[model samples]
Target: MFCPKCGATIPDSDNKEKSGSKVVKNILLVLLILVLMAVSGLGTAAYMMFHNKSSGATYEGKGYNTPEEAAKAYAEAFANKDINEMLSCCAIESYVDNLDYEAQIERYGAYMPTIFGGPIMTGDDEATRQINIEERKGQLTNFIIRAYLRVSQPIDSPIFSGLALQVGDGKEYDADEVVDMLKGASDIDSIKVGDVEDCYYFLQASSNDNSDKIHKTLKKVYGGKIEWLGVELEIDGEDYVMFVDAIQYDEKWYILAPHGTGASIAGLDVYSGGICELALLD
Candidate 1:
């Protein structure tokens, strides 16, 4: 050993060169790790950006697989004959109409064959590649859907147009049609229940036939509570608020709401009668 106390080149057998080399390798490894961390962060950001762009939408209530999923859920409710289940899937505004879910269950129970067996999907405008189901759901709650999809086009609720067209089509109008329509229009407990003012002039083309009969039918159902409000439908065993979307023409009035629902009626043609299903609150 030469000059052991001085800083000088050591013998080849010493570990100094290897120690320096190891420190260099550690520095390189640290730098490599930092680079990898940066790359990982960038990749995460890119994934989030793409995912948000492709599959994200802001929703206030209820988790959903898609808008289509909600639509299908509504259909499933009907298919299972669980009226409350179907209503539970609906947006708040519909229930807010004062026709609470319980009323819907009682009034619509007799018509399960029509509601559940009905199609949840259909083509519009000759298969124009439209988002019709979403548009329909955006238009009406399943409780108010009707086969008179044609009538549902011009008017807001299929219940009204469904009945009008049914009567106009001469589908053997009976007491049930009148009862169903009147029931759908019955949620007057709250002011906004009947929204015909929000939708206008489509039924001007309806036959206006049996307007008096329609009015009387309403009175029969509500037990004439309107007094000056013309005919009414009886709540009878129902626990629902009632209101009407009435139209005056040829000196007669028509009722739509608690009396009208997506519930279907027999002996009616929904199309060509210028009626529509109730509007949906998506």
Candidate 2:
């Protein structure tokens, strides 16, 4: 063979070397294209999976366009005692998603009664049905909070009562009686409570004269176990610290033992405890 550009005679050995080099270069190019295609395919698959998992706030479902809408639909379903519809509005937490639907509801029953008024039961189907009925009432109460939210109502609004219940073991008080108990308590200037869904309560309290008075009052209400109600607000020129209380209770707000007042309720794990978020009404 001869070089076309230079018109120089070329050896067979040189021609063979050049041919071999071209073949190797072609092979390498093909391999690179294949690798790139594979990578692209994997990336596309991952993106599609993520997109499908997160259907966004606009998921296609009846009466649910956003999280708030889903919440309302779920609450309404609970009120109507439609378990299937309530479950439809809910996307299980990933950790608990592996559990079957009935199991999920049963697990939810631990804290379900707090927001959906009913007795917590285990095993028996009859007990489960009765609990479901009670939960409907609990769900209805929480829905009132949602109704307040849709109109931009503040947490301090009397339309929703303030959070002031002792979660001790006892017969539950009616809502009116609970409010009376809170109002009757001493050492607080003003208190306002509201519910954020069926999850938790928002509480705001102003100290009467100074922090000392409020602190003493809390000590009285809670019998010296009042470490959490330490919320304080300054009106004229006093400094106050606020406390967030999370307590568990019955259908009527009877006090549960105040141990696990953590962020259980808002996180939908209220079977452990309920929480009170205290802040200045300003």
Candidate 3:
């Protein structure tokens, strides 16, 4: 008999059992391939989803077309105590990209021998060293970001109220309370965007030598793709300005962290401080 699907002649009754087994094997093989393809598709989709989320491409507040818009959104998020929104407006991926473990090691390698009495060893081999560096970088980034978020809240909101942060003066205060005091005594009156050009110039002029080097490095790396904007928050009639470093990635703007105080906390060598005072208003 002829097989209808393949138009091939089927084995006769003499070989019927063998022919049946062959057909079953083929069917099983096709099913296995289908299953593998489905799994691969799902895996690819999942990876893409994760990448988009991490890169802020899928973030709701990531669609800001300009630096001013992003800064305004961040200020509004801060006022509303919206953590997710505030994070969305940040250029987290940019900060991550700028973290160069290899460069850091190279720059600090000379000092390591003096401190350790020998060459500081990261791992047994090159591959292992790379893996170890990446792991450390991830840990450092997480620590800095978490610390920043912990303090980046309204002082009166009760969020992170239990966490005590010591300011430049060596006085310990509740994270929330410190932020509230910095924001001012009353509710938010208005959020204003300062001139981008003027903000950039001010940042460059006011930055210390190390900070100036970082700014220049970032400018050299990003060229015309990055911007500096000042976000002025008028609370209780007092105008407090926060300078933000906005980076353009995939045609979207995101606020770069470790700009003011964040950078100081993370160490200026690890992350570059922007041209703003205290990195952020808070």
Candidate 4:
């Protein structure tokens, strides 16, 4: 047999001599101690490694070691409609503060469909709608239950989950309704959420398409070089472009938004057009 975690072979007890068995048992005990210690150390190391010093609970890891890797992971998470995983790929501090789990979930529920796809409309099927409602209820219930179980863990609480959930006239978003907006689109590139500098660089790099005009305009306000990308689509028979704002952190890429995230990052608004407006990708 092989050890599940490390894939190392484990000898059967029956094959060992009496003395060998004692040695093996001792070795196993030592290995177990080492494994426990490693696990304890790894948890801390992982937290420190992935955590953003300025923000709270933000983590970007698990093979998302490069800009391209993170971008792919982001796209995959979107494709999977995994909200937590998707948010992990991007810088979400602008909207999501620490221990603001409800807001995190709500924002995720709202923006995900818009950025990735649209709401799933159950077409006049009573049973389907009921099932969807039940599924959402189950998810929320599970979250509550898990949160309750981990009540002792201070970090687990999103600054008191029950209070957060109960506050305000919280609009209940049916979780099942969220769908991927980017399903039909091709894979995303390793673009980053750079500052005004990215805009400057984008304009500088391009010889045509109003480069000089755009460059001067950027310089007049905030100047920096960063990558800017546009995803094109047609909505309601009209051409619409989704501008992607990305940033590089620790050499990995993250999209600010599939569209501009309602605010600027690094003193640069990736897209100034209306949320539904069209911008030709020149």
lDDT of 4 by residue, 71-157 (tens): 455545543536567556654332122113333335445434223212133343544433433443333233323312221222223
- For residue 155, give model 1's deviation from the true position in Å: 17
lDDT per residue for candidate 3 within 141-221, as digits (tens), equals 443343234333333433334444675545655566666644421333444334333253433345468755766665454
Which is better, 2 or 4, measured by TM-score? Answer: 4
Worst 10-residue lDDT window for candidate 1 reads 225-234
| Local error of candidate 1 at residue 85 (angstroms) | 1.5
**Residue 161 of candidate 2: its Cα lDDT?**
53
Best first by lDDT, ranked: 3, 4, 2, 1
Cα shift from native, residue 212, model 2 (Å): 41
Better of 2 and 3 by lDDT: 3
Q: Positional deviation of 247 in candidate 2, in angstroms?
A: 25
Model 1 spans with C-alpha error above 4 angstroms: 1-61, 93-282
Q: Best lDDT goes to which candidate?
A: 3
CA lDDT, every model vs. true structure: 0.34, 0.35, 0.49, 0.38
- Candidate 1, residue 99: Cα displacement in angstroms equals 19
List residue ranges in candidate 2 displaced over 4 A: 1-119, 149-153, 159-282
Q: How big is the positional error of residue 43 in model 2, measured in Å on the Cα after superposition?
A: 58
What is the full ranking by TM-score, best candidate first? Answer: 3, 4, 2, 1
Instruction: Tell me each candidate's TM-score.
Output: 0.20, 0.21, 0.42, 0.28
